[model samples]
Target: MSSTALRRSLLAASAVLVTAGVWLAAGTASAGTLTGTLYRDTDTPVARWLAANPGDSRAAQISSRIASQPATRWLSNFNVGTIESEVAGYVGAATRAGQVPALTVYGIPNRDCGGASAGGAPDLATYQTWVNGIARGLAGRTTLIMLEPDSIALQTCLSAGEITARDQALATATRTLKAAGAKVYLDGGHSAWNAAAEQARRLANAGVADGDGFYTNASNFQSTANESAFGRSVLSALSGRGINGKRQVIDTSRNGGAAGDWCGDDNTDRRIGRYPTLDTGDANIDAYLWIKPPGEADGCAYPAGSFQPSLAASLATGAANPPTTTPPATPPTTPPTTPPTTPPTTPPTNPPTGACGATYATSSSWQGGFQGQITVKAGTGAVNGWAVSWTLASGQSINQVWGGVLSVSGSTVTVRNAAWNGSLQPGATAEFGFIANGPAGTSSLSCSA
Candidate 1:
């Protein structure tokens, strides 16, 4: 062979070897890398239901849909004697599966503010010991830790000294969880609760710098868009206060569509939201998660904590976008000269021109009960107050509502603004939710303001 030919052949062989080596490395990384949020793959309520009722079509459907989805495992039972072993077991299983485990370390003192889902360590010392055990069980494995859901958000419910102690406990817990190779996310209340600045300040005070970032909409029914926007605002505020590099994850489990009244029962209108993803496009946003498992009770349908199979099945099988029928235009009601002490049973006839408009949806339903939500949009002008009215289909009756004053007379229901949520500027929106009892679900609802 000529010298030139020999040289060319040698160069081509070298190039081929390098290219093959690159391809092999790329394939190895792709196979071994943990790319997305981890699916714990543990048995949940839906799984248990499916196992017991193999012949039930509804249970089967729900099982099939959520069996593979990722959910946060809660570690809120302070009384459980074997917490360390349980945490270790969960982390070990997740590590073997090549996934990260997400846990909620809920048991802070004064937890849930004595609400239905209330109970925590009797004192701060006990809480610290419990958290230390959790950290010890993690054993330096990569895990996701969602701190107490309402711990920082509901600080106002505590006395001054209690708030100080809560802050110290949270800080200690944050440091402990992080030292064990866990990514800790502090709680930031939903968009509707705290203003961005106030929430950011509270997070900073709770030692957010010791963890990965903050989480929003934990067990709440706010839309992903709204939560994301709120998350950004809070992050920006944190940044302004010199707290940088903080990332956020949102609870998209039940916020499939629009925002709903957080305090309503039977809200079956909620559908499963965006699947968990690490590549959220936004730099500061980490993942969208089912922090609150979809099928679990939200304290309303089944005694605040008990699982409701009917409600769970409804949520699992429902459509993300249920068909909505626009109600016929009703003449605007006259502005009340004085705000009524009670929500009027009858809707006003003349609402101010461009006062507000509303859209309603049945969030979820079971055999004899259903949940409903209303979103009132402020018109071109500011709205000092507003009222919405809707007539239920036969057999439906409003039982309880939150975020608004609800007055029901037979099938017709009138909802007036609650004291705190009554005012809105142009383009602003106010949402309220309620639960009703009926056999026929709220398939079609007409709402007008």
Candidate 2:
């Protein structure tokens, strides 16, 4: 899609992008990192929902599925009891492991620009009440709070008159949280999604003056180079607005590399970072964080609410293990096995434009094997293996494979264990092919091929 069309779609998604949160540290350290999701100690509707269901399911699933989007990352459905317990678990783990955990709080209202990730405290009054409870849970703990992800920037969807009231509430929340002693990093969305000036203006207007600064690259990838560029611009704007005194953080969670898509579509599986460590490359940038748990859905990319285990494994600490090797073959001259392939078919189509209603679409495609092509350009940087995964609508099989190994499970296809074209640079393109055979009229395209 044209950049203009992409921006329009992003602005529309700005409403939903407002829906999440993240965490980081006060000082820099070596690369290994600690990260965790915030869960309430109370066993409210959300806890009840997770308990009753199994395997990556949660109570928010009902509303989220019905809305055809992700459930707001922050919701009050978690009771105080759950909050306390969860916080204790986080604190305890951090304390014991000697690692700080990155956490996000999303219970704020109108998250994600009213995208599928909407919902929050009923109003400012109620949100403050919830904040009080959250503060109590966070008391004496050293944790970074990604305060109200999309609340500030995405508020344009609100009626003009209501904007002041919204800002007022945000100011109040910022003060209250800061007073409670929590280190708060207000989300600045990603580098590509919001203009620096506009982001700074909204943040300043929303009272970021009282904040620790802003966060960028949260759950989106525009590249660290781009993010740093974008962040400095936004910070410059914020400075102009008199809110530049604070530092900023970026969600380095899944952005080991960059692609245009949101989900794991590029599936580059760059093992540049694990938990707590950040390579953000900016001193004022504070820290790079894995705020978004590796492998968690940006929302169902392949199957509704299903977690991509391979993708998850690739992201998790498991990637550190040594690879297994086979013993020498009986026939010393035997040729090695050829990688998987399918009969030739249609070449890849260009990537589609606009943010589709489908959850986690960006991160879930092969990204036209662009990720593999990244290093080809530089020809000098270290190159690692690659993996790409996607879930077909069902009844689909590998029509062809080029440079990578292909594995199938039910409706999902994972590309691993094959030769990638060349070293992948920050933003490269790659493509794979597939053909679906289902009942007549059942095999319609779910999105751009």
- Winner by TM-score: 1
**Candidate achieving the largest lDDT:** 1
Model 1, position 6, has a per-residue lDDT of: 4
Q: For residues 111-219, what per-residue lDDT tens digits would candidate 1 score against the true structure?
A: 7775545545656776787788898888877677789998888876799888888888899999998887677889888888889999999989899977778888875
Q: Which segments of model 1 are wrong by more than 4 Å? A: 1-34, 320-449
Q: For residues 164-271, what per-residue lDDT tens digits would candidate 2 score against the true structure?
A: 877787777677766755556676877777788988888787777886777776556556677778878888888786665666676654555445665563365533
What is candidate 1's CA lDDT for residue 103?
Answer: 80
Model 2, runs deviating above 4 Å: 1-81, 96-98, 263-275, 278-281, 300-306, 313-449
Q: Rate the local accuracy (lDDT) of all candidates.
A: 0.63, 0.44
**Residue 172 of model 2: what lDDT?**
77
| Per-model TM-score versus the true fold | 0.64, 0.52
Instruction: For model 2, give the 10-residue run with minimal summed lDDT.
Output: 1-10
